[model samples]
Target chain A: MDKESYIFNKFKNSLNGDDGAVVGKCVYSKDLFVEGVHFRREWMSLTQIATKSMLVNISDAIAMNAVPKYALLGVSLPKDISVGEIDELTNGFLKIAREYGVQIIGGDTISDEKIVISITIISKTKNPIYRKGASNGDLLAFTGNLGDVKKEFEILENGGKISNDSKFYIPNLKDKFFYKVAKFINAAMDISDGLSKDLSRLLKVNSLGFKPLLKLSKDELCSGEEYEILFAFKPKFKDKILKIACKTNTKITIFGQCVELDENTKFINKCKEHHF
Target chain B: MDKESYIFNKFKNSLNGDDGAVVGKCVYSKDLFVEGVHFRREWMSLTQIATKSMLVNISDAIAMNAVPKYALLGVSLPKDISVGEIDELTNGFLKIAREYGVQIIGGDTISDEKIVISITIISKTKNPIYRKGASNGDLLAFTGNLGDVKKEFEILENGGKISNDSKFYIPNLKDKFFYKVAKFINAAMDISDGLSKDLSRLLKVNSLGFKPLLKLSKDELCSGEEYEILFAFKPKFKDKILKIACKTNTKITIFGQCVELDENTKFINKCKEHHF
Candidate 1:
C-alpha cells in the first residue's frame, strides 16, 4: 500500500474515510493550499489564493449536501507580505464567506518562507452522502463541464493570458442543485483529484467498478481541481435528476454506470494520484 | 498597531478577541506549527513535534474551560519523510488524542519542503471564559510553575538534551482545576505567547492594566509556550479557588491583580511578540 493508504488504513475504524467526517448532524472538512504545490504567487493574487482556499474547503461540505457554517483558517505567510496584502487576503476570505454564509470563526497566523493556508469548514447535514453507498448498475453523473479547466491551465502555463471569467481559479459549485438531489443520490464526492482517481476511490469503497457509457476527453478524465460533484444513483432517478438540474440551471451529464468487476468490463485509470 | 492586531482589529466586531472563536456553545481554535518557525526538525523528533502540535491547540480549549471533542489536522509534509516517521507522528497524535478523548474527525495532507501542521480543535463550553471580563482589583492567578521551559528551550537550542519529563513538550494542564473554578473566574487564557504579551492583549481588550504583586524573573514572564492558564477572579473567591486547586493537586500562584491603566502602574513588555 502507498503511504497515504497505509496510514489511513491504520485509522480506518475510527475514520469515516469520506471527504468530510460526520459527527451527529455536523460534517467537518479540511483542505490545504500550499504556495508552490497548489498555486503560484505569480499566477494568482493573494486575494485569489485566499478566495480559492475557502471555496475549495466549502466544496467538500457542499458535496456532502451540507450548508457551510463556520471556518477556521491556519496561515503561514512570508515576511515580505505587506499589510495591504494581508488586508486583501482577509477581504478575499470575507467575500467568499459572505457568499456562503460561513463565519470565519478562528485561525492562526505565523511566519514562513512560503504561504500555507489550511482551512477547516464546519457544516451540518441530516443525511450525508457517502462514497460507499453505490450499488450495482447505479448510474453515475457529474455536475458542470469538465476539461475546460485543463484548457485554461495550459493557456497560463504557455505564457498566455487566461480570460478573467475563466473558471480555473474559481469553481462554480452547484450546491443548491446537489442539495435538491441529495436524497436521490446513492453515493457522491467532489472531483478534486480528477474524475478517474476520485471515481476509483468511490468504487473501491463500495467494492464495485465502473463502465463508461459516454466518451470523455483525456483532459476531462485526468486534470484535477474540478471541485464538481460526481454522484451515483439508480437509473430510475434519471428523470427526476434531469428535472432538478433543469430547474436549478445546473449542467449534469450521465457518463457512466457502476458495474461488476470483470475482464470484459472497461475501467479507466488515466488520472494522476496526488502524491504527498 | 502591530501586524497581527492591525489585521484582527479589522474583524474585531465579528470575533470575540479571545484564544478561540465562540459560536453558540462551541469554540473553535486553530494553531499553526511550521518548521523553523515553531520548531526545528533537528532539535526534536517527529513524535515530539506531533505531540506538541496537538497539545498546544488543546491548551486553548482548556483555557476556555471547554471539553475538546474533535480535531482537524492539516499536514504539509516534506518529500523525505519515511513511512516509519509518518507512523510515529500518527502515534504521537493518537497518544494525546486518547488522553483528551478527542477524535481525529478530518484533515488534509500535501507535500512541501517544510512540515506544517495546522491543527483545528472543536470544543464545547456552556460558559467560555474570556479575557475581557476581569474587573478592576480582580486577583490574577496562574497554574503550575514557570521559567523552567525557557531553560529547557535554551538547552535544546544549544545541542543539549531536554529531560523527558520537561513540560516544554507536554504541558501539564489543570483542566479539572479550571473547570472547578469556571464559575468563579472572570477572565482566563493560556500563556503561549508569554505572560507579558498575552496579558497585554487581555488588558487592552478590557481597557485595564495589571499590577504584579510578586517578583518574577524575566524568563518567567517573557519566555513563551508556557501553556499555563492565567486567570483573574474576585478576591472573595480566593479561598474557594485554593481549596479546588488543592483538591485537584494543582499549583496555583496569585502573582498580580487587575488595575486601571495609569502612568504610575507598571506594564511588562519584555515578552516576544510573534510577527507575521
Candidate 2:
C-alpha cells in the first residue's frame, strides 16, 4: 500500500466503538487563519498560535451558548517549514484542548504557500443559544470593553507603540473574562466585524431594531478585533447573571441594552448620537 | 449582527430547541483539492466542476459505511473570480447534492491566492461499515474495474488527445457504469490512489492480507480523480449479491478472495502472481 493509504487505514482503525471510542452527531466547522489576516507567528508564540486558532471558534460556540467538545484541524505549511516546528504547533494545540477538556478528533495536512491553519470544532450543549431570541425588554450587554482591539490592531498595523497594558488588555485579561460570560446570555454573539457591522447583523436577523445608547468614550471604540462577546437577557434574568458572575469572578459591561423592537437598529456609542 | 451572526441567527430561529436543540459529530473525514494539484478550471465545465467536486466526497460516506447526508464546503477564490462564477460553482454542487439526496447545511468562505475547495461530509448510518471489519475467509471483491481512471487521466493530462481511443474508451464506459456499480459492493471505497495502494489500506485495516488479482494492463498509474469503489463480502451473502446485481444490471468483479491474514499482500491476476 501507499504511504497515503497507510495513513488512511490507520485513521480507519481509529474509528469504531472499540477502546477509546467517543461519538456524537456529525458536525464540521473550519477556521482558516492566514499570516497577515489572523496572526503573526513572530509576535505570538506557537502556543498562542494554536490556542487562538482554537479559541475563535470556541468563542463562536460560546456565543451560541454551546459547550465545545471536539476539534478537527487542517494545517497547510510552506515547503521550508520543519517537521519539529509542525509538531510543536500541534502539541501546543493539544495542550490547550486537553486543558479545556476537548478532544483533538481528526485533521488534515497539506502543502501551501503560507501557514493556513484550518480548524473545525464540534461542540454541544443541551440548548444552543442563538442571537434571535431577544424580547422587547431584553437587556443588551457585552462581556468586556469593545474598542481596545482596534487600538491593538492599529498598534500592530502601524508597527507603532503598544503599551504593556494594551497588549495584556485584549488577549489576556479581556479574553479570559469573556469566556466565562458566554453561558450567561439568552442570545449571544461576538463583535468580530466591529460593533457597528455586527450589531447591524444581529438586528437584521432578529427583525428587531433597538436604539443603542452610545454616549460613552470614543477612543478604541470605532472598530478592531473586538473578540469580546455581546449577549442579551430579559430584566428578570439580571440577578441570575449577577450570581453567575459573582461565582466566577467574571466582569461584564452593559455597553447598551434593548431599547426598542421597531424597524432598523438605531445604535449609539461615544461616536454617534442616535436618530433612526 | 454581522453576516456571520445574521446567518447563524436565521438558522437558530429556523430550528428552535432550548439548552441543546441539536449538535452533530464532526466529520470523520476531511480533504482538500487545490488548483494545480487536483483540477484546472480551463478543462472542466461549470457543471462538471461542481459535480466532480461534490462527487469526490459521495463515496467517502460509503468508505465509512455511513449514509451520506450533509456537506459543509469551504471555498477560497481569487479576487478576479466573479460572484457569478461562484454562484455557478455552488449551483453545480447543490445540483449534485440534490442528486444524492443530501443538503449543504452550512460552511464558511474567505479569499485565497489560488482556488482551494475543502469539504467535510456528515454521514448518518446505524452500523457504519469500516475497513477493519473484513475477517479471514471474507471474499474480497470490487464493484468496478481498476484501469479506466488511469486511462482517462492520461488522456486528459496529455492535452486532451481526442484522437487517442485507447485513453478515452475506458473512462467513457466508466462514466456510464460507475454509480450503479457503486450500489452493490460491501465495505466499498473509491479508488483514489489506485487499486494497488487502496487495497493495501483495506488489508491493513482488516488485519488481513489478500491476493491482488489486478488484471490492469497499465503501469505507473497516478490520478487523484478515480471514484470507483472496492469492498469485501461474507460467503453467506454470495447468492444475495448475485441476485441483486442481476436485478440491478450492475457488474460485480470478483477480484481475489481473502485466504489467510498476512502482513504482506500477494497479487494474482490472469495466472500471473506477485507479492509485496
lDDT of every predicted structure (CA atoms) = 0.85, 0.55
| lDDT over C-alpha atoms for residue B214 of model 2 | 47
Judging by TM-score against the true structure, name the best candidate: 1
All DockQ scores? 0.68, 0.10
lDDT of model 1, residue B57: 93
- The CA lDDT at B232 in model 2 is 81
Per-residue CA lDDT of candidate 1, range A221-268, in tens? 886888999999999999999999999999999999999977666465
lDDT of 2 at B251: 71
Off by over 4 Å in 1: A262-268, B266-268
Model 2, range B61-102, lDDT digits (tens) per residue? Answer: 555445556665656666466645666776777777777776
